[model samples]
Target: MSIPHGAASAAARPDRVDPAVRRIGATLVVGALGVVFDTTVVSVALDDLAKAFDAPLATVQWVSTGYLLAVFVTIPLAVWAQARFGGRRLWIAALGGFLLGSVLSALAWNATSLIVFRVVQGLAGGIMMPLMATLLMQAARGSHPGRVMAIITVPTALGPILGPVLGGLVLHLADWRWMFFVNIPFCVVGGWLALRNLPDDRPEPGGPRGRLDVVGLLLLCPGVAALVYGLSRVEGGAGTTGAAVLVPLLGGLALVGGFTARSLTRPGGALIDLRLFRHRAVASSAALLFLGGIALYGPMMLLPLYFQQVRGEDALGAGLALIPQGVGALLARALAGRYMDRVGPRRVAVTAFALVAVATVPFAFVTAGTGGAVLMAALFVRGIALGAAMIAPMGAAYVGLRHQEIPDAGVITRVAQQIGGSVGIALLAVVLQHAAAGAHGPSALAGAFDRAFWWSAVLTALAVPLCLLLPGRPEPPPPARTTRTGEAVDPRRPTV
Candidate 1:
């Protein structure tokens, strides 16, 4: 096949991202923004939603909970769905589903209806999240993974920074429905971009397509959902001893265990390829990502609460206070990507995790009287380290993976990070509850938060050594070959 002039130029310039990869990454980011932003944006509006529908907080909480559960339930399906349909078709369809759900959610007459619509959103959003990474990685064809991942991660980095601020502004200035309305433009623009820029790579008719693994889906989907649900209940202060927490936790574990056994027995046909775990890059990246999730998310739960309960900030004020952390995260992206592409993921991840642990130490001593400037400085440092920590392992996960294997790797890494987040939030919530038991004043509550932050720092520190397990400095790509017509072409680049 003749190489396009743009492809030839990209092949010759090893440091520059391919024009095609950039286009795909940009398209995916536009679509992914709605999903990422929606997750955080709806969080700040729960109180308003409760009052708007005149429903109890517990029942209304399902608007978030249902969406989350639906997300988990459908996450395992991304690889299969992408295989069954082409990436381009799946992307547009999922974007449309999210848009439809967003509109319905805006018009929801009650909490139940809102929860249902949010689930619809979740089902689509879940597929898009992992598939976004899969499509980008596949298109990248193993070149400049660090740079590609940096682009892929933009929506995620921005979500925590912008979602809450936007949500707060919407609630203050307009009706709650505007929260869902905000998703419309992202979905519409993203879909249009996908149609225009994404390559149509659907499988040929009657080609060998992987069949849906019905039994695996039944076992894993509900299993992960149950696990996440149980952990969420813990975060809600239900305690670990309650039937509400124990039943789901145990059942989820058993189902997951069953899926694992079944997958091992039938590796080739399983919903996700268990054999990928044998690859050090994939295995180590998943492990580090799990811990990274804890480091990033556990502290996330505490930081906002610390601002609110100890510092007397309202929701908007708390969101505003977090801007420093978000800024640090944004700043870390380019530097982290550059270094990971240079010295490899190992050095970057280890240094990043160590920095994260060190930065978190300031929170361990937090008091109601702590200076805002001091706390913000610490958060800024932590955010930079956290951003680097996430980028390294994520990019490393695809190192040495084949084109067809990228989708399964995406699903694996994403699930690990998410489950880790749930575990971190649940564990920290329990620790805070116990530490703050019968706390009489802000000082005592601050003491309790200190203990929780200590735990967060300790967990983060544990991931540092694990970072060593990631692949070291990447080997340089072989020089491109020239066709008889003198056109440079990359042998490794897969045709989309």
Candidate 2:
């Protein structure tokens, strides 16, 4: 259900992060960093994998593709897994799976083995990311969303900034295996924290477990994975019309359509409750995030390629140049969260999306000789818009949700953003391919990127109007307890 604007007056939502929030937030962030870094960090090592395995580029690409499919396919299982084993247990187990996969991947002797191991990593990672958000939000209990989100977003903001740099450095220094090796410390520490800090809430003291939603899983899992697989194929010379693209793309759609129909029939029992979308916040936020995935991911691809191809910078140089954007993203969180609580996500999302579109205009006008300082400043501003833009909708999605509802919300939003990302990358790849068809110079490549940036700006612009549909001000926190005699009573509940 949509949380009415009046539910949380200006007086209700706190602007500051609480001390308890800080403790859990820190722990969750630490555990989540491994997944974030591992995902982005591996992108820069694809070429190394191909060479090391003496395999075709397409074959080596599965190191990433297989992981992606596995992530999507396994994501649907998260709701069921969390409910069956409890969040704490599921989190620890997933982290353990990821850690084991990382170790096995680092030890693999062949590309096929590495690809198989990556699937394990993806399955674990897909669950962890959504579960991380769900656990943290439930802990927050609808207070200080801005502050809570700021801490949660650190990994995301840091990933783009550090992942490529870290990946490049690893390839230059040690070897590709270290990419997987680096995840060890994070997993070990995260697991330790889970064991120590997280509350254990086993279902009914190990009585009969929740019935598995077998039909929903069968429909939703492959359905989403198929869609992403289709998009991945769309980027190559095959194009959207080719059999390679159309078969899975259309087939995935049919399956998903069927899943939606099936979910409608299952109510609370569906793996992901489709009824949740009836709330304006969830549905609208999902839409904006869908577009956001395109705007953000599409431009992310263009930015690095732009610097390297147009400016003739090395990978390290491009990473360094993009540092300003990362800084902006990190800096925006504190302010964005505060304002989101104060003015509400609707207003903040509108302004932020517009700002993103405006900031992108400069990149859309780039030239071969464009000054680095000028472009850097624009990127910094764009990052600021992006940081706020991402947080507002994310916080809004959970505004009126009951505790149990958060798991489904998490899965829905993750799937939306993930599929949106795949769509963005595929579309931009096609556009870039066409624009560079006859181009032969740095100037020509710059033009191709300019066109792509325009597409990104248009995407952000498109999301602006939809901000109106986000949840209003977070419902004011519940008032303090009172006794029959009007004496104050503690509302404090047992730590869960």
Candidate 3:
């Protein structure tokens, strides 16, 4: 009846990371980039996918939606998989699975088939993203996390900014299939590196690694999948009636709630560590991530529409216009990371949120006749603010968590962000629909978009105070010592 608090062995050697660990970290980043690249690539390629399959836009949209829902379904399984199979093996397997799925997707001929293949990719992707975090954080157990996190997050920070750009470029010259093909080399290299360099951090003796939680997976996966499905439906003109939306949504809630109750009573490391919720920092980080998700992605949906609908730009032209935002985001990541290290999550998050609020204000003033110069400047500022805001709070969430706990945090933050995006998209869609209902011309649609921007700005502002709640400066790294056998040992073990 006792909880296994000593989940990883305390006496294990933990000294300076070997060259192998460093190599593995770099390889994981490459693999991580490939995952993000695929995610962004599909966003840019949706139209092409639909056209190629001769499917309706609504149906084809599930290609992305299904992939995301599949991610949610698979994420909780990472903890169990890692405990049973070891982090190295699981990661290499995930990368291989992703590569295989990408190949299948590229070869798919119909929208339905592509969606199914995308789901396969998503399931594997879901495992990789969090496991990457888990493994890195665990490896850096006795090290300075600020520096380690900075190194790990570079690609994640770059992915959003670059994904669209790369996706656009691919669409311009090569076919959509090339995006999937691109992942092949990265996966092969990543797998090889994982096999060669990834550390072997096995579960402690007597740690929970028994039968799979069949009932839990059934409830949890479907629950999350249904909720995301419902949200995606909201954007597909299924306002309330054309909606089979409520069915999955309500069912999802019930399943999640049921599984949660079961997890609390059953055993160690419940699909997600519900114990993490007890931490105020984790809870607040999740809430802010939800709001930040809205700020980050909601405008993405609106901006492209404004460019095409009001500014009369083609897809390529619109992509070009978005370049400034990406450039600004790329420029801000390092500075933001360094600041987060020095001043802690609170100051960094608050400052970043303020900048985001200020930057987003310009969107409220956008008009049909607004000059491209002014809009570009606004987007640039917004991008910089977005970059800082995104990384600061993410760093904050793991401020005090131990090595093994980081994976759970990754799942938590990711799910929070995605769910937030779904809500933001649906809410903004409805708001714009209502806002645009009153008029018939370009000016009217512009006015509707402006209204949406104002709301998004308000949402960004609301997160500022929450950011203030994040913990101040991180603790110093643990000290390392050596035993007669020459294995590194953590000095903090006795104290814990």
| Top candidate, metric TM-score | 1
The lDDT of model 1 is 0.90
- TM-score to native of every candidate shown: 0.97, 0.93, 0.89
Q: Summing lDDT over every window of 10 consecutive residues in candidate 1, give the lowest-scoring window.
A: 1-10
Q: Model 2: which ten-residue window has the lowest total lDDT?
A: 1-10
Pairs clashing within candidate 2: 8-475, 8-476, 146-337
What stretches of model 1 exceed 4 Å from their correct place? 1-5, 482-487, 494-496
Task: Name the better of 1 and 3 by lDDT.
Answer: 1
Across 467-489, the per-residue lDDT of candidate 3 in tens digits comes to 87898886654556777987556
Candidate 3 stretches greater than 4 Å from native: 1-22, 202-210, 240-242, 265-269, 485-488, 492-496
Q: Assess each prediction's global lDDT (C-alpha) against the native.
A: 0.90, 0.82, 0.77
* Candidate 3 TM-score to native: 0.89
Candidate 1 differs from the real structure by a C-alpha RMSD in angstroms, to one decimal, of: 1.6
Which residue runs of candidate 2 sit more than 4 Å off their true CA positions?
A: 1-15, 206-208, 482-496
* Rank list by TM-score: 1, 2, 3
lDDT of 2 at 202: 65
